[model samples]
Target: MSVTLKLATSLDGRIATAAGQSKWITGERSRAAVHQLRAEHDAVLVGAETALADDPELTVRLPGYAGRQPARVVLDSRQRLPTTAKLVQTAREIPTYLVATEAPQARLTDAGVRVLQAPALGEDRPELKAVLEALAREGLRRLFVEGGGQVAASFLRCGLVDAVEWFRAPIVIGGEGRPAIGALAVAGLADAPHFRRTEVRELGDDLWERYERI
Candidate 1:
Protein backbone atom coordinates (compact mmCIF):
# COMPACT_ATOMS: atom_id res chain seq x y z
CA MET A 1 0.00 0.00 0.00
CA SER A 2 1.14 3.55 -0.70
CA VAL A 3 0.91 6.25 1.94
CA THR A 4 0.66 9.97 1.26
CA LEU A 5 1.16 12.45 4.08
CA LYS A 6 -0.57 15.83 3.76
CA LEU A 7 -0.35 18.97 5.84
CA ALA A 8 -1.02 22.73 5.56
CA THR A 9 1.24 25.10 7.40
CA SER A 10 2.51 28.67 7.58
CA LEU A 11 5.63 29.88 5.81
CA ASP A 12 7.52 29.42 9.06
CA GLY A 13 6.59 25.72 9.01
CA ARG A 14 4.17 26.05 11.88
CA ILE A 15 0.83 24.25 11.69
CA ALA A 16 -0.77 25.87 14.69
CA THR A 17 -0.44 28.47 17.38
CA ALA A 18 0.95 27.67 20.80
CA ALA A 19 -2.55 26.97 22.05
CA GLY A 20 -3.36 24.54 19.19
CA GLN A 21 -5.63 27.00 17.38
CA SER A 22 -5.29 25.70 13.78
CA LYS A 23 -8.52 26.55 12.05
CA TRP A 24 -8.30 28.68 8.90
CA ILE A 25 -4.54 28.39 8.46
CA THR A 26 -5.10 27.87 4.77
CA GLY A 27 -7.85 29.47 2.66
CA GLU A 28 -11.07 28.02 1.23
CA ARG A 29 -9.34 26.85 -1.95
CA SER A 30 -6.82 24.81 0.01
CA ARG A 31 -9.60 23.35 2.14
CA ALA A 32 -11.57 22.42 -0.98
CA ALA A 33 -8.47 20.89 -2.56
CA VAL A 34 -7.98 18.76 0.55
CA HIS A 35 -11.45 17.29 0.04
CA GLN A 36 -10.46 16.39 -3.51
CA LEU A 37 -7.31 14.73 -2.21
CA ARG A 38 -9.36 12.81 0.33
CA ALA A 39 -11.64 11.63 -2.46
CA GLU A 40 -8.70 10.14 -4.34
CA HIS A 41 -7.50 7.98 -1.46
CA ASP A 42 -8.93 4.73 -0.11
CA ALA A 43 -8.77 5.92 3.49
CA VAL A 44 -8.11 9.03 5.55
CA LEU A 45 -6.09 8.77 8.76
CA VAL A 46 -5.24 11.01 11.70
CA GLY A 47 -3.54 10.69 15.07
CA ALA A 48 -5.32 10.58 18.40
CA GLU A 49 -4.40 14.19 19.15
CA THR A 50 -5.90 15.36 15.87
CA ALA A 51 -9.06 13.35 16.48
CA LEU A 52 -9.44 14.99 19.89
CA ALA A 53 -8.47 18.51 18.86
CA ASP A 54 -10.02 18.88 15.41
CA ASP A 55 -13.00 16.53 15.65
CA PRO A 56 -12.91 16.24 11.87
CA GLU A 57 -15.64 14.36 10.06
CA LEU A 58 -13.09 13.03 7.48
CA THR A 59 -15.71 12.72 4.73
CA VAL A 60 -15.90 14.22 1.27
CA ARG A 61 -17.85 17.47 1.54
CA LEU A 62 -17.82 18.53 -2.11
CA PRO A 63 -21.03 18.88 -4.06
CA GLY A 64 -22.02 16.03 -6.39
CA TYR A 65 -19.52 13.71 -4.73
CA ALA A 66 -22.12 11.01 -4.18
CA GLY A 67 -19.56 8.22 -4.53
CA ARG A 68 -18.38 6.16 -1.62
CA GLN A 69 -16.32 8.16 0.83
CA PRO A 70 -12.98 6.88 2.03
CA ALA A 71 -12.73 5.00 5.30
CA ARG A 72 -11.74 7.06 8.35
CA VAL A 73 -8.94 5.69 10.56
CA VAL A 74 -7.37 6.88 13.79
CA LEU A 75 -4.10 5.88 15.44
CA ASP A 76 -5.15 5.83 19.06
CA SER A 77 -2.54 3.55 20.57
CA ARG A 78 -3.93 3.52 24.08
CA GLN A 79 -7.58 3.26 23.01
CA ARG A 80 -8.26 6.68 24.48
CA LEU A 81 -10.51 7.55 21.57
CA PRO A 82 -13.68 9.01 22.95
CA THR A 83 -16.98 7.28 22.24
CA THR A 84 -18.61 10.65 21.53
CA ALA A 85 -16.11 11.57 18.81
CA LYS A 86 -17.66 12.34 15.44
CA LEU A 87 -15.82 9.41 13.87
CA VAL A 88 -17.38 7.08 16.40
CA GLN A 89 -20.81 8.67 16.12
CA THR A 90 -20.94 8.26 12.35
CA ALA A 91 -19.07 4.95 12.13
CA ARG A 92 -22.18 3.03 11.10
CA GLU A 93 -22.94 5.44 8.27
CA ILE A 94 -19.35 5.62 7.03
CA PRO A 95 -16.63 3.10 7.82
CA THR A 96 -14.48 4.21 10.79
CA TYR A 97 -11.54 2.40 12.35
CA LEU A 98 -9.52 2.85 15.53
CA VAL A 99 -6.04 1.26 15.57
CA ALA A 100 -4.75 0.72 19.05
CA THR A 101 -2.14 -1.33 20.95
CA GLU A 102 -4.18 -1.81 24.10
CA ALA A 103 -7.58 -3.41 24.64
CA PRO A 104 -10.45 -2.19 22.55
CA GLN A 105 -12.80 0.40 23.95
CA ALA A 106 -16.12 -1.37 24.42
CA ARG A 107 -18.28 1.74 24.19
CA LEU A 108 -16.69 2.69 20.88
CA THR A 109 -16.95 -0.87 19.58
CA ASP A 110 -20.60 -0.98 20.60
CA ALA A 111 -21.03 2.25 18.67
CA GLY A 112 -20.00 0.41 15.48
CA VAL A 113 -16.34 1.41 15.32
CA ARG A 114 -13.85 -1.18 14.07
CA VAL A 115 -11.22 -1.43 16.77
CA LEU A 116 -7.91 -2.95 15.69
CA GLN A 117 -5.13 -4.15 17.96
CA ALA A 118 -1.51 -3.88 16.78
CA PRO A 119 2.11 -3.84 17.95
CA ALA A 120 3.43 -0.92 19.94
CA LEU A 121 6.26 1.39 18.88
CA GLY A 122 8.29 3.87 20.92
CA GLU A 123 6.57 4.97 24.13
CA ASP A 124 3.52 2.76 23.41
CA ARG A 125 2.60 4.39 20.11
CA PRO A 126 1.01 2.19 17.42
CA GLU A 127 3.57 1.17 14.81
CA LEU A 128 2.77 2.63 11.40
CA LYS A 129 4.02 -0.38 9.44
CA ALA A 130 1.67 -2.76 11.27
CA VAL A 131 -1.18 -0.28 10.88
CA LEU A 132 -0.52 -0.04 7.15
CA GLU A 133 -0.43 -3.82 6.83
CA ALA A 134 -3.73 -4.05 8.66
CA LEU A 135 -5.20 -1.38 6.42
CA ALA A 136 -3.90 -3.06 3.28
CA ARG A 137 -5.38 -6.39 4.34
CA GLU A 138 -8.76 -4.67 4.35
CA GLY A 139 -8.10 -3.47 0.74
CA LEU A 140 -7.26 0.10 1.63
CA ARG A 141 -4.42 0.32 -0.86
CA ARG A 142 -4.05 4.09 -1.05
CA LEU A 143 -3.85 5.94 2.23
CA PHE A 144 -4.13 9.66 2.97
CA VAL A 145 -2.42 10.50 6.26
CA GLU A 146 -3.78 13.83 7.37
CA GLY A 147 -1.96 14.97 10.42
CA GLY A 148 -0.98 16.38 13.71
CA GLY A 149 2.86 16.70 13.59
CA GLN A 150 3.75 13.62 15.62
CA VAL A 151 1.84 11.30 13.31
CA ALA A 152 3.53 12.58 10.18
CA ALA A 153 6.94 12.37 11.83
CA SER A 154 6.27 8.79 12.88
CA PHE A 155 5.38 7.65 9.35
CA LEU A 156 8.27 9.56 7.78
CA ARG A 157 10.70 8.27 10.37
CA CYS A 158 9.54 4.72 9.66
CA GLY A 159 10.11 5.29 5.89
CA LEU A 160 6.48 4.43 5.19
CA VAL A 161 5.49 7.63 3.39
CA ASP A 162 5.49 7.24 -0.38
CA ALA A 163 4.67 10.87 -1.10
CA VAL A 164 3.90 14.19 0.51
CA GLU A 165 1.46 16.99 -0.29
CA TRP A 166 2.42 20.04 1.71
CA PHE A 167 0.55 23.34 1.44
CA ARG A 168 2.37 26.42 2.66
CA ALA A 169 0.51 29.61 3.47
CA PRO A 170 2.07 33.04 2.85
CA ILE A 171 2.02 34.32 6.39
CA VAL A 172 4.41 33.32 9.14
CA ILE A 173 3.39 32.17 12.59
CA GLY A 174 6.13 33.44 14.80
CA GLY A 175 6.74 33.08 18.53
CA GLU A 176 6.43 29.69 20.13
CA GLY A 177 4.19 28.23 17.40
CA ARG A 178 3.78 24.51 16.87
CA PRO A 179 5.95 23.07 14.08
CA ALA A 180 4.45 21.05 11.26
CA ILE A 181 6.83 18.09 11.85
CA GLY A 182 8.15 17.14 15.25
CA ALA A 183 11.78 16.36 16.18
CA LEU A 184 13.80 14.25 13.73
CA ALA A 185 17.17 13.07 14.91
CA VAL A 186 19.95 13.81 12.46
CA ALA A 187 23.70 14.00 12.92
CA GLY A 188 24.50 15.57 9.56
CA LEU A 189 22.92 16.93 6.36
CA ALA A 190 23.00 13.45 4.79
CA ASP A 191 20.58 12.17 7.41
CA ALA A 192 17.67 14.29 6.13
CA PRO A 193 14.94 12.75 4.02
CA HIS A 194 15.00 13.92 0.40
CA PHE A 195 12.17 14.11 -2.12
CA ARG A 196 11.85 14.98 -5.77
CA ARG A 197 9.31 17.72 -6.40
CA THR A 198 6.64 16.41 -8.74
CA GLU A 199 4.38 19.44 -8.99
CA VAL A 200 3.65 22.85 -7.55
CA ARG A 201 0.46 24.90 -7.76
CA GLU A 202 -1.00 27.93 -6.17
CA LEU A 203 -4.05 27.56 -3.97
CA GLY A 204 -5.26 31.07 -3.17
CA ASP A 205 -2.47 32.62 -1.08
CA ASP A 206 -1.05 29.18 -0.35
CA LEU A 207 1.39 27.09 -2.39
CA TRP A 208 0.83 23.35 -2.64
CA GLU A 209 3.96 21.29 -3.29
CA ARG A 210 3.72 17.65 -4.25
CA TYR A 211 6.79 15.46 -3.91
CA GLU A 212 7.68 11.82 -4.36
CA ARG A 213 10.25 9.80 -2.43
CA ILE A 214 13.68 9.76 -4.05
Candidate 2:
Protein backbone atom coordinates (compact mmCIF):
# COMPACT_ATOMS: atom_id res chain seq x y z
CA MET A 1 0.00 0.00 0.00
CA SER A 2 1.14 3.51 -0.82
CA VAL A 3 0.59 6.44 1.52
CA THR A 4 0.15 10.00 0.31
CA LEU A 5 0.90 12.83 2.71
CA LYS A 6 -1.30 15.85 2.07
CA LEU A 7 -1.00 19.25 3.74
CA ALA A 8 -2.08 22.87 3.40
CA THR A 9 0.40 25.38 4.74
CA SER A 10 1.05 29.10 4.61
CA LEU A 11 3.77 30.58 2.41
CA ASP A 12 5.77 31.04 5.57
CA GLY A 13 5.50 27.32 6.34
CA ARG A 14 2.91 27.51 9.10
CA ILE A 15 -0.19 25.31 9.22
CA ALA A 16 -1.97 26.95 12.12
CA THR A 17 -1.92 30.09 14.22
CA ALA A 18 -0.11 30.46 17.50
CA ALA A 19 -3.23 29.46 19.38
CA GLY A 20 -3.99 26.50 17.05
CA GLN A 21 -6.53 28.49 15.04
CA SER A 22 -6.37 26.93 11.55
CA LYS A 23 -9.69 27.81 9.99
CA TRP A 24 -9.62 28.84 6.31
CA ILE A 25 -5.87 28.81 5.81
CA THR A 26 -6.21 27.85 2.17
CA GLY A 27 -8.50 29.26 -0.53
CA GLU A 28 -11.78 27.66 -1.60
CA ARG A 29 -10.29 26.02 -4.68
CA SER A 30 -7.60 24.36 -2.62
CA ARG A 31 -10.12 23.16 -0.06
CA ALA A 32 -12.32 21.79 -2.88
CA ALA A 33 -9.33 19.99 -4.32
CA VAL A 34 -8.76 18.37 -0.93
CA HIS A 35 -12.28 17.00 -0.98
CA GLN A 36 -11.66 15.51 -4.40
CA LEU A 37 -8.48 13.87 -3.11
CA ARG A 38 -10.42 12.49 -0.18
CA ALA A 39 -12.88 10.96 -2.62
CA GLU A 40 -10.02 9.14 -4.32
CA HIS A 41 -8.36 7.67 -1.23
CA ASP A 42 -9.46 4.53 0.66
CA ALA A 43 -8.78 5.91 4.12
CA VAL A 44 -7.90 9.24 5.76
CA LEU A 45 -5.47 9.22 8.70
CA VAL A 46 -5.00 11.96 11.24
CA GLY A 47 -3.28 12.33 14.59
CA ALA A 48 -5.03 12.60 17.92
CA GLU A 49 -3.91 16.21 18.26
CA THR A 50 -5.70 17.17 15.06
CA ALA A 51 -8.80 15.31 16.18
CA LEU A 52 -8.89 17.23 19.43
CA ALA A 53 -8.01 20.58 17.87
CA ASP A 54 -9.94 20.62 14.60
CA ASP A 55 -12.78 18.18 15.34
CA PRO A 56 -13.01 17.48 11.61
CA GLU A 57 -15.66 15.09 10.36
CA LEU A 58 -13.19 13.93 7.63
CA THR A 59 -15.92 13.47 5.05
CA VAL A 60 -16.02 14.51 1.39
CA ARG A 61 -18.24 17.56 1.40
CA LEU A 62 -17.76 18.96 -2.08
CA PRO A 63 -20.82 19.66 -4.21
CA GLY A 64 -22.21 16.53 -5.91
CA TYR A 65 -20.21 14.39 -3.47
CA ALA A 66 -23.07 13.62 -1.13
CA GLY A 67 -22.69 9.88 -0.73
CA ARG A 68 -18.92 9.56 -1.13
CA GLN A 69 -17.05 9.23 2.16
CA PRO A 70 -13.81 7.51 3.11
CA ALA A 71 -13.06 5.64 6.31
CA ARG A 72 -11.87 8.07 8.96
CA VAL A 73 -8.85 6.86 10.93
CA VAL A 74 -7.33 8.28 14.08
CA LEU A 75 -3.79 7.54 15.32
CA ASP A 76 -4.29 7.70 19.03
CA SER A 77 -1.29 5.97 20.54
CA ARG A 78 -2.31 6.37 24.15
CA GLN A 79 -6.01 5.97 23.42
CA ARG A 80 -6.52 9.63 24.08
CA LEU A 81 -9.36 9.93 21.60
CA PRO A 82 -12.35 11.75 22.98
CA THR A 83 -15.68 9.95 22.95
CA THR A 84 -17.47 13.21 22.22
CA ALA A 85 -15.37 13.94 19.16
CA LYS A 86 -17.18 14.85 15.96
CA LEU A 87 -15.29 12.10 14.13
CA VAL A 88 -17.14 9.61 16.31
CA GLN A 89 -20.56 11.23 16.26
CA THR A 90 -20.73 12.35 12.59
CA ALA A 91 -19.27 9.17 11.11
CA ARG A 92 -22.54 7.28 10.77
CA GLU A 93 -22.04 5.89 7.27
CA ILE A 94 -18.27 5.83 7.06
CA PRO A 95 -16.44 3.61 9.53
CA THR A 96 -14.05 5.16 12.07
CA TYR A 97 -11.11 3.25 13.48
CA LEU A 98 -8.99 4.18 16.47
CA VAL A 99 -5.43 2.84 16.39
CA ALA A 100 -3.93 2.90 19.84
CA THR A 101 -1.97 0.91 22.41
CA GLU A 102 -3.49 -2.12 24.15
CA ALA A 103 -4.15 -0.11 27.29
CA PRO A 104 -6.86 2.00 25.63
CA GLN A 105 -8.19 -0.63 23.27
CA ALA A 106 -11.13 -1.78 25.36
CA ARG A 107 -12.35 1.68 26.20
CA LEU A 108 -12.26 2.74 22.57
CA THR A 109 -14.03 -0.43 21.53
CA ASP A 110 -16.71 0.23 24.12
CA ALA A 111 -17.19 3.68 22.61
CA GLY A 112 -18.43 2.05 19.36
CA VAL A 113 -15.28 2.60 17.26
CA ARG A 114 -13.22 -0.33 16.12
CA VAL A 115 -9.96 -0.41 18.07
CA LEU A 116 -6.69 -1.97 16.98
CA GLN A 117 -3.54 -2.28 19.09
CA ALA A 118 -0.29 -2.11 17.13
CA PRO A 119 3.35 -2.13 18.23
CA ALA A 120 4.30 1.16 19.82
CA LEU A 121 7.44 3.13 19.00
CA GLY A 122 7.72 4.31 22.57
CA GLU A 123 5.62 3.96 25.66
CA ASP A 124 2.48 5.34 24.00
CA ARG A 125 3.42 6.14 20.41
CA PRO A 126 2.47 3.80 17.60
CA GLU A 127 5.21 2.66 15.25
CA LEU A 128 4.55 4.09 11.80
CA LYS A 129 5.75 1.08 9.83
CA ALA A 130 3.82 -1.35 12.00
CA VAL A 131 0.63 0.66 11.71
CA LEU A 132 0.99 0.86 7.92
CA GLU A 133 1.57 -2.85 7.64
CA ALA A 134 -1.49 -3.53 9.76
CA LEU A 135 -3.59 -1.25 7.61
CA ALA A 136 -2.24 -2.92 4.47
CA ARG A 137 -3.22 -6.31 5.82
CA GLU A 138 -6.73 -4.96 6.23
CA GLY A 139 -6.77 -4.14 2.47
CA LEU A 140 -6.27 -0.39 2.61
CA ARG A 141 -4.62 0.28 -0.75
CA ARG A 142 -4.27 4.03 -0.70
CA LEU A 143 -3.78 5.90 2.58
CA PHE A 144 -4.14 9.67 2.80
CA VAL A 145 -2.41 11.32 5.74
CA GLU A 146 -3.74 14.71 6.74
CA GLY A 147 -2.06 16.02 9.81
CA GLY A 148 -1.12 18.83 12.19
CA GLY A 149 2.67 18.28 11.63
CA GLN A 150 4.11 15.61 13.96
CA VAL A 151 2.25 12.79 12.23
CA ALA A 152 3.48 13.90 8.83
CA ALA A 153 7.06 14.05 10.07
CA SER A 154 6.84 10.56 11.50
CA PHE A 155 5.68 9.07 8.19
CA LEU A 156 8.40 10.88 6.30
CA ARG A 157 11.03 9.80 8.78
CA CYS A 158 9.88 6.20 8.49
CA GLY A 159 10.10 6.39 4.65
CA LEU A 160 6.43 5.43 4.38
CA VAL A 161 5.38 8.54 2.45
CA ASP A 162 5.20 7.83 -1.27
CA ALA A 163 3.73 11.13 -2.39
CA VAL A 164 3.20 14.66 -1.15
CA GLU A 165 0.50 17.18 -2.09
CA TRP A 166 1.14 20.56 -0.58
CA PHE A 167 -1.05 23.65 -0.95
CA ARG A 168 0.76 26.85 -0.06
CA ALA A 169 -1.49 29.71 0.85
CA PRO A 170 -0.30 33.30 0.28
CA ILE A 171 -0.68 34.28 3.89
CA VAL A 172 1.94 34.20 6.65
CA ILE A 173 1.37 33.09 10.21
CA GLY A 174 4.43 34.08 12.15
CA GLY A 175 5.47 33.32 15.73
CA GLU A 176 4.57 29.98 17.44
CA GLY A 177 2.45 28.11 14.86
CA ARG A 178 3.00 24.56 13.63
CA PRO A 179 5.31 24.12 10.63
CA ALA A 180 4.44 22.67 7.22
CA ILE A 181 6.47 19.56 8.10
CA GLY A 182 7.20 19.11 11.78
CA ALA A 183 10.72 18.95 13.18
CA LEU A 184 12.64 15.75 12.50
CA ALA A 185 16.21 14.64 13.09
CA VAL A 186 17.07 14.56 9.42
CA ALA A 187 20.82 14.91 8.98
CA GLY A 188 21.12 16.80 5.70
CA LEU A 189 19.53 17.44 2.32
CA ALA A 190 21.33 14.38 0.93
CA ASP A 191 19.63 12.26 3.58
CA ALA A 192 16.20 13.40 2.39
CA PRO A 193 14.34 11.10 0.05
CA HIS A 194 14.34 12.15 -3.62
CA PHE A 195 11.04 13.57 -4.86
CA ARG A 196 10.10 14.61 -8.37
CA ARG A 197 7.63 17.42 -8.80
CA THR A 198 4.76 15.89 -10.74
CA GLU A 199 2.25 18.74 -10.83
CA VAL A 200 1.88 22.38 -9.93
CA ARG A 201 -1.21 24.57 -10.18
CA GLU A 202 -2.61 27.78 -8.94
CA LEU A 203 -5.70 27.33 -6.83
CA GLY A 204 -6.91 30.88 -6.53
CA ASP A 205 -4.21 32.52 -4.40
CA ASP A 206 -2.74 29.21 -3.19
CA LEU A 207 -0.08 27.27 -5.07
CA TRP A 208 -0.58 23.52 -5.09
CA GLU A 209 2.55 21.44 -5.54
CA ARG A 210 2.36 17.69 -6.07
CA TYR A 211 5.47 15.55 -5.73
CA GLU A 212 6.06 11.84 -6.21
CA ARG A 213 8.88 9.78 -4.78
CA ILE A 214 11.62 9.25 -7.33
Candidate lDDT scores, in order, read: 0.91, 0.85
Top TM-score model: 1
Which candidate achieves the best lDDT against the true structure? 1
Q: In candidate 2, which residue ranges exceed 4 Å CA deviation?
A: none
Tens-digit lDDT track for model 2 on 89-190? 754556788888675555456666877678878557888877877787777889999996989988888888899999999998985887868867879999
TM-score, structure 2 vs. true: 0.94
Q: What is the TM-score of each candidate against the true structure?
A: 0.97, 0.94
Superposed by TM-score, candidate 2 places the C-alpha of residue 40 at a distance from the truth, in angstroms, of 0.2
Tens-digit lDDT track of model 1 for 1-214:
9999998999998999998888889999999999999999999999999999888999999978898899999999887778778899999999999999988878989999998888998899987888999998888999999988999888888888899999999988986999888877756878788889999999878899999999
The deviation in Å at residue 20 for candidate 2 is 1.4
